[model samples]
Target: MEQKSVWLDEIKFKAKPSLKEDINCDILIIGGGIAGISTALELKDEDGVVLIDKGKIGYGVTSHTTGKLTYLQGSIYDDIEKAHNFKTASRYLESQLYAIKMALDNIKKYGIKCDLEKNNSYLFAAYDVDKLDKMKKFLKKTKIKYEECDLPVNIPNINAIKVNDTFVFHPLKYITSLREIIIKSKVQIYENTRATSISFEKDYYKVTTLEGNIKAKKIIICTHYPFFVIPGLMPLRLSLEKSYALLSPYKNEKFNAINVDDEVYSVRFYKDNIIVGGFSHPLYKNINYKKEEDKLIYFYKKYFNKDIEMAWQTHDLTSHDYLPMIGRLNKNHPNLLIATAFNKWGMTNGILAGKILADLALNKQNKYADLFRLDRPISFTKVTNFITNNFMVGKTYIGTKLIKNKDFYKNVHIEMIDGKCSGIYNDENGEKHIVSNTCPHLKCSLIFNKLDKTWDCPCHGSRFDIDGNLLEGPSVFDIKLK
Candidate 1:
């Protein structure tokens, strides 16, 4: 009934628009969430940069995130080290640390009132008590310095392994601050701008929107889930992870002094508000949003004795190696770069990505650029990823061919080639247009989620408007006709 910005509801502003005529820019950044805004803000003073958003800025996945900027991604270091030796894992860790620093510096420089706070982050144990041991061993192998602690939080049936320090801030406030700077820098911020098509000709990237077009020396596919499928091959490598959270009823109402890493759950407090999050599931074809919400409710009822206030659900782009795919979209599309699949760890990652992508766009050098490059090899241990990720994507292909017969209404969810996800709508027009059927994220085939009129993705859990435009990510593109 009531809609407001998640953590920072006080923010108010109007969504901007794309230029209606041909304009040249040094770089074109798509998707105006934290990532796009960060890039545009970083390069705003620099020439030839324009940022566009499918909707309003800060309304994408960045808004729904439990913003905890930290290096501790609870119970991930062990797998990271195991998947690709300690050395490479250390690189990933260091890269994340570098991102954290970038955000800190910008916050200070801009004097952003994003409620920036420093605290110790935690990854506690619920089931496997030895999870911390693997992290310890991995840290030792990498020769990284970290301190452990007994967590002081009051909760039932929990054990804690402390990460030295972590940070939290109001992400929307940070993005809003960047938006102000970008506006002042003369980088156009276009809200409600949907990029319809993109082409590369004569080494100039041309992005066509419903209203106009833009020509740029380079293009960035930061629209959460990329619009075009060719560059990132996002359909194949990334799967959708839908998660839920609740913000309400302060207990000690203590904010996360340090980021807390829990796969099933994450805890943080914003002033008097406590945010409890977790309930990650594959957002595949026929994925149940209600089931996802029920899980969050179960966790809430079990843990806290308070009324739940604001609740939100969102999806993340999870990659094969659990890192992220940044840098060029593909070799053939050299001038195009992509930033997606952040594993729901977007704030710092996105900040670092702005720097790395900005440098690459400028053809300058960035050391970690190699770490997140698009063409990085998928290692042997990650072969399992290929199968699991592909399995999810297969549903899209199958969903596309459900049935064409008009009477095929029993299982009527189908992805039309015209990019429409249609139901049997007897419109006032007295006929059917067979509206946009493609999942907004990665153009996956959407199966009719009987429980919800929402079409569900088998690859990533991007929902859509009945017309097939984006309702969620990793896709920011809505399914609409040309």
Candidate 2:
């Protein structure tokens, strides 16, 4: 079984060159995931637009997603209504529906073959009938058509609601095809170019990358987690969640389902394989990575009774208000925009973010702009969650610093080497690999991910390979010991 995302298997693309010298552009985008690529596609006709990524396009969080394009997200409208109001929730629902249509229109216009399959989406409840009922009421209030039905999969559920106008597709295939189209336009794309910092100049912002500087009149941060904090205070408003997924060979199913229970189990299909994902927890709360992954595997085996072919995990940033932040960073810098905290529904939110962000950058008035602005009014729930989430982050940071020399796995151990805190892993050939145990972003101690054999930061979601190369980040610098 492979330890990587199934979407990344056998797909190939020629990576664009990294930025080598200082360059200037009218607009500079600092990520290459779904959000970044989508935004680039929107601005392809505009002159002097450049996009750069620390790694290749479509290989980051986008590759690890479940790739469901459905507005029937698991109780999102209910959550939004509870957090804000019905009007807000309804507007958010409208945005999602519009985003789905945008995706379909783009696919049709470009003739992109991404295995787009129209299927029914189900929201089921095994024990949480009250939550399912609440979702049903919300759907009815929003004038959405849904049916009472049983889940097609052989999972224990008491009630289920179904919507038929949803879809599942290959996220990487869609993104790579968009990348090909963007490359043929005027937008410049560079891979392996990490933006380390951004500084405000007299008339523009200067982004400092590893190899060069990017000066642009407008900047959009599409990075999953923004490296900076002061402009938006993103860390306080956002929390990270990690979920596990596994694939097993099965006949293609025409439906996808997610339960509204405390432990979310999302099931979908790709060709002849069944993909099951769930077992989510706050990034700071989950340190036993292997045990968490095992729970999902055990759950799949109990129901599907099939051998797992591949497994992977992903982290998502969730906002306190349960809405994506998709406008200017702050009033002081309208030119500095950002789109993040999708709350695990990146396939829809990311696509809509492109239109909202592009409209903001171009000084055009997008109808949904006010709905997802970064400085929107905060609710009592958002304030409470902000304090709780940050408190957890602080506790985790201090807790990791206090512990040392702990062994998470037999092959991996943390120890002090030459007076420096280092993590050591012994390979199958008995070769020892060592690197700094501290995360470069905030100096938080790293936890060894046993299943993936990588070091992950529990405070934030920064990750590194066994050799200490940066994989995902709010941290751009690698953890390799100098």
Candidate 3:
């Protein structure tokens, strides 16, 4: 019998109360997902490390992912070349390949019993069968070892683009092990704690949270999205794309990894069942969170009802150029770094980022640093693609704000202009004040989700507190009282 996720409720974490008193650490790692835990594990041999998660680790996008480990990231190389150059694309693929090997090595090193499987990864094709031709051209130009081969998938009427040496494993299990290692390293791990706000104070950085504050020499944002909004502008710099995954019982299907061209669908056999993942889009266009779940259930009923065991969901943040962003935040904030925007290639890239970041934190030079540079130049196509995709979010946000509600009591404030949501609070002087009503993210239209008591972004699914503080992101920044 396949064991359930380590995060199941029966599990108990007898952790001490987080750092209530102000303390300093050499590094303050935020967001205990794969990137954060992996980073902490890499830096475990180093001294003075602190890692904190708003909730338990591995519960973020990593938990919900299909966990495909391969260098073939959907239609990304085509865009990578346009955004930067062919050399960048070559470096990216090479780095991704390296990351995959690193992941396997780490699993072996820890003896993590996550159902790791080696599968042949395929970038399946649909209307854009020509995409294979494109890949061939890129292969020749970059002098990389790959082929334009038709995949042997059971699914009919679709051509496959095969990328060799891909693997899949249970992400949560891998991350949990990393977390354990980080914790055992004597590195401080805090759960259910948040870094509410951050400010640079001279040589140190002050990280304020609802519970307490921490003074650290360096901060690493593995939060997936940078919570500090305007300065980092992660939401604006990046795009949020979501995909679905279904894990059903396996009943003798022979093949490896499979992803259709145009990324309509992807499938891989995992443990007892085949993990079906893919069918992606910009976050705002298909805002129905349950669509993926529904698809999984529907697939179970129509196709493989017998072997099916469980269903899981995951989200990935894709950059415009379809690559992971790693390295330092900027020259000014040298101590601060980010490893995010994996573009669905987080399995390897996320792990690799941790190693590179650990080296960076310890003042050791990493060879891959230049390729994953934080501030790469964006081409015209990238800018256009970003603007085009975000326009829907902008429009949605603006349209929602124009709605006039008489029942919107004192607690309700709306932005007359972009229609983003704002919080209504009474001041000591009893004055009515209004704030910007939209999410600072891709400017998704905000709806007051009554149950959550927060302004939820309909576009990319970010949630903000009634006071406009960040409850969730793709937005990264909170709704501000402008």
Candidate 4:
């Protein structure tokens, strides 16, 4: 099946100019998805704020989300409270509400036509009664109003907690509108210009790309995953998971909904279609991407009787502590900021990060700043997750590297080139393309994503085209082609 989001086809965006020479700015923001673009919008009034992306704005993982804008995320409050504290979870709730208001206000102010609709959102459960009870207790403790209701689908014995005044919209449309506003303001925007590396000079940071270098007083690493590895230790603290979504004609599904099952499913409506998204799992060697996609379709077809219109996939980084990490990159690098690990709640978290990051850069005080501090102290709550995630990383590194077999599929094989690992794919037209199988970022062996026909690094979320061109990265360089 072809892998493309239904949201991508809703807007026809004009191309922006790519960076071709070195430039100086007050602040440099990298990554052009929701977080990067929203940060640019917040900083537009400030002088000399520049943003750059490897691809076009709004085309990354943001384009592939379910696009639900709700503060009542599925069991997020319970998870955060368990991982951190009640105060931290409450602050997280505040940030999400603030983000939703910010987005809605901006859409109204800019007259953005993004199909925004006020739909109730729900957290439902069939078998996970304990989890659902915990969510209710958290909601009650926070004083957020919710109601018990029947499941919207045909599923039996399922109950849901619903929050009114929530919303759903076309994310690409909203992002495109925001991009236009930022471009018209003081922000300098560039696309197709990747930030390859960063170095500190006397006082400022120099971000270099193939096109040129950008010298800025402050740098924000908003790329889905920060390319810098030293202080953040992102690989040790995070894990990558891929999720699938299917869009098809709708019937009577009313509210945006998700369940609290181990194998979770979230369904929402857009245009005349119902988008059912779920089937998330950690990235690992020899996992069949096609089978994952099929599983999503099968579940949707079993529940709803509609022909699938489009199917797609998205990848996300989940922080070990469950809450997002947003603040300075480390204790020493105050001028460097990092925002990542939204835990599949990027829509609200990304927007909220923009607000928090802008405050940090502009020297303004944000109430929720300390809640998401990158230098947060290690606690007993975080210890178990840290050990489990890091152990999995080690397993992925050693396990994928040890596979020496050449035969993968009929046309794809792993072999040696110049005494190093290489993947060779012979297309239907009999053209041979060979590229390194080792990720340039951490040397983790790459896995073939058959559904997208890209080489994916299961360890750090780097991706490359079959032709050896970098698609997404912490790895700024492409796989070596021979």
Candidate 5:
């Protein structure tokens, strides 16, 4: 099966050219996904604003999302309440609700043809009755109206909480509409422009790309995984989780629901397809992709008699504390901002971050900004979690070095090239291609992702093509070819 997002195929937009020369702008936004575009749209009135993407706009995480936008995230409020406080949870919910409103307002005002649908969102629990009760109590405390109901699906769930005014939409189509407005508003957009390094030159920041440099008064790093390491140190604060998703013939479901049980299962409908997403794990280990797909199919067959049409996978950055870090990259540098660790709910958090980042860049005050502040004091729990998580990554990095070639796949193995480690993939046609096995970001050893046929860094979620071309970041440089 081809690895592609159904949403990407469902919409089309004119492509923007890569940056060909050095340019200066008032603000520079990197990463052309939902967050970057939303920031550009919020700054539409500002002149000399530029946005650049390593690939095409809306083709990154935005296209690959399950596309459910709602404040009823799976026990997230409860989780926040446990970790922080009720006020923090309320602020998070308010930010998300405002994001939903902004999305709806833009869709109606701009008349975006993104198959937007207003529906209720549900969070159900099968065996976790206490969890459901706790969520209900939290909602009651917040004065948010929620109903307890039996789930419509065949699966046996003890209870489900339903919240109204939730939504699902074609993310790419929505992005198309946003891009149209951004273009008209004069935000210079450039695709295929990979940002390599950033530096401070006098009062302005210079962001160097593969083709040219962009000098701007301020910069927003919305690259999903923030690239800069020194100030932000994103890898230490976040862990990457990969999840699989598939599309099937539309099941007439009136609501989008997710179960935050031991195993997660999120379901929503867009157009004639029901998007089933979940089965998450850290992607460092060898995964049986076929087995995961089988699980999704089995679940579908048991409830709905529909054949799966498309399948894909996506990665999300989860903060140790459960709240997204959305503020200055470093406390010392007020002009540099970042937004990461959405924890698979980027549809709302991503856009919400854009608004916060825009406010920071424009010197406007926002009430919810402190909830996701970048320089917040790290709790003991966060510190311990960070240490434990990095230990796993380090283990994987060392273990990959010790694994012998004889134990590798029939068509793939690792070997030394000019005294340097390299991965060798023997294609079905019997042609062997060799590329450096070391990730350029943080020097973590790369693992071959058989499902996607790309080399992935277990430490920070950087991805490179089989030919060593950079596919995604936190890593900006491509792996060296032998």
Candidate 6:
């Protein structure tokens, strides 16, 4: 079985050159995932616009998505109403619908063949029927057409709500097609170009990258989690969760379903494979990643009784208010825009963020800008959640620092090498790989991910390979021992 995202199979695109010299542009985007690529597509016709990624485009969080395009998210409207108000919930729903339309429009206009298929989206609940009822009421009030039905696939559920006019597509195909268009346009793209720091000049911002520096009149940060905290305090405003996914060969099903239970299970299909995703928890809370993966494997075996073909995992950022932050970082930094915290529904939110961010960058007014502005009014729920999330982060940070050499695997252990704390992993070939055990982002202790053979940060979500090369990050530096 492959330890990678199912969407990454067979799709290939040419790699773009990384920035090799100091460069200047009118706008510089600092990520290449859906949010970044979508933003670049919006500004493709604009002059002097550039996009750069630490890795290849469409290979980050976007590749790991389930790729469902529907406004019938699992109890999102109800959750939003509880957090804010009905108006906010309704507006959020509208934004999602509009984002879906935007995606459809782009697919049609570009003739992008991404295996787009129309399907019914189902939201089921095992014990939280009240939550499902509230969502149904919201859909009714908003004049959306839905029907009470059983899940199309055989899974444990008490009640379900189904909505038509929704769709799913291959996420990587859609993204790579967009990349092709942007490449042929005026927008410049750079892969393997990591942005390390940003300094504010009098009239512009300068972004320091690995091999070069970028000076731009405007900047947009679409990185999953902004590496820095000053302008937005992203670490305090966001909490992250990691989820496991596996695919099995099965008959194609035209419907996708997600349960509203505490341990959510989402199911969809691609061609002849059944994709199951669930087993979500607060990121880095439990370091036993292999056990977590085993739970997913057991679920697939129990339900579908099929052999797993591909298995992988992904991390998602959630906001205190359960809304995406997609506007100016702060009033003082109007030229600096950001889009983050998709709340596990990045396919739609990322597309909408692109529109909102593009509009803001061009000095145009987007209708939904006020709804998701970074500096919007904080509610009682947001304040409480903010405290709760940051408290856990603080606890994890301190707790990881205090613990030393707690072995979770036989092949991996922490030890002092040359008077420095280091992580040692014994490969199957009986070779030892060693690196610093400290996360460069916030100095949190690194936990070995046994399933993937990597070091993962428990406080933030920064990840590194066994050799201590940074894989994903809020950290811009590698953890290799000097």
Each prediction's whole-model lDDT (CA): 0.72, 0.91, 0.69, 0.85, 0.83, 0.89
lDDT of 4 at 378: 70
TM-score of each: 0.86, 0.98, 0.82, 0.97, 0.95, 0.98
Model 6 root mean square deviation, Cα atoms: 1.2
lDDT of 1 by residue, 1-482 (tens): 12223654767787675557777787899888877887787787787778877778888889888899987786666666666767778898889888898888888888888988887677666656677667767766766566665556555434565565578988888888888888888677777777868888897988897667889889987877776656336677777777777777675725353222344678888877788877677766435566666777777767676777777777788777777888997778788998888877899889988888888888899999998897888787667886776775675467554644344334343444543445443334555434455555555555544333555565656677555556665554665566
Colliding pairs, model 2: none
lDDT of 4 by residue, 230-299 (tens): 6436777777888999888886757898877777888888877788998899875336788888988887
Ranking of predictions according to lDDT:
2, 6, 4, 5, 1, 3
Worst 10 residues of 5 by lDDT: 283-292
Candidate 1 Cα deviation (angstroms), residue 217: 1.0
User: What lDDT score goes with residue 422 in model 4?
Assistant: 91
Go through the candidates in order and give the clash count of each: 22, 0, 13, 0, 0, 0
Badly placed stretches (over 4 Å) of model 1 are: 1-5, 140-148, 154-158, 253-263, 396-421, 424-454, 466-469, 472-482
Query: lDDT winner among the candidates?
Result: 2
Model 2 lDDT per residue over 140-256, tens place? 998999999878889889999899999999999999999999999999999999999999999999999998999999999999999776533768889999999999899955688
Model 1, position 383, has a per-residue lDDT of 71
Error of 3 at 305 (Å): 6.7
lDDT value, candidate 2, whole model: 0.91
RMSD for all candidates, in order, please. 4.3, 1.1, 6.4, 1.5, 1.8, 1.2
RMSD to native, candidate 5: 1.8
Comparing candidate 3 with candidate 6, which one achieves the higher lDDT? 6
lDDT of 3 by residue, 214-235 (tens): 9999999898776666443466
What value does the lDDT take at residue 103 in candidate 6?
A: 97
Candidate 2 Cα errors over 4 Å, as ranges: none
Model 4 scores what on Cα lDDT? Answer: 0.85
